[model samples]
Target: MTDLSNAIWRKSSLSGSGNDCVEVADDLPDAVAVRDSEDIQGPALTFESRQWSAFVSGVKRGEFDLA
Candidate 1:
């Protein structure tokens, strides 16, 4: 598992009132660490920077509808 002791996590701005969202850390130079906001001390999934960018772009494009 990656040592995320210094990773800075941020949740989605549109996250609901409840604690239901994914947290991400961009402090890593070549990867992004993601975890459930409801599980702070839980394990996180790491992805390559390029892959993360693509995922964000897809989100902005509404490829994954929230409604």
Candidate 2:
């Protein structure tokens, strides 16, 4: 399991506008952690390094729309 005790999570700056933005923690040795910014005590999702890379690429390519 990922050790999130020291993980640093950050949400989008626009989250102040009341959007339910998700927060992500980088710097994990082999994976990335994601969770709902609005629910800090909620369950988190972990993704392998490679999978995270692909997901990010897809986001940049507009395959997913944040809006």
RMSD of each candidate?
A: 2.1, 2.4
| Candidate 1: pairs in clash | none
RMSD after Cα superposition, model 1 = 2.1
Off by over 4 Å in 2: 17-19, 65-67
lDDT of 2 by residue, 1-67 (tens): 9998888898878778774899999888888999987789989999998999999999999999867
lDDT of 1 by residue, 1-67 (tens): 5678999999878896878898999889899999998999888999988999999999999999978
- Which ranges of candidate 1 are over 4 A from the true structure? none
User: Candidate 1 — what's its lDDT?
Assistant: 0.91
Best by lDDT: 1
Backbone clash total for model 1 is 0
**Residue 7 in candidate 1 has what lDDT?**
97
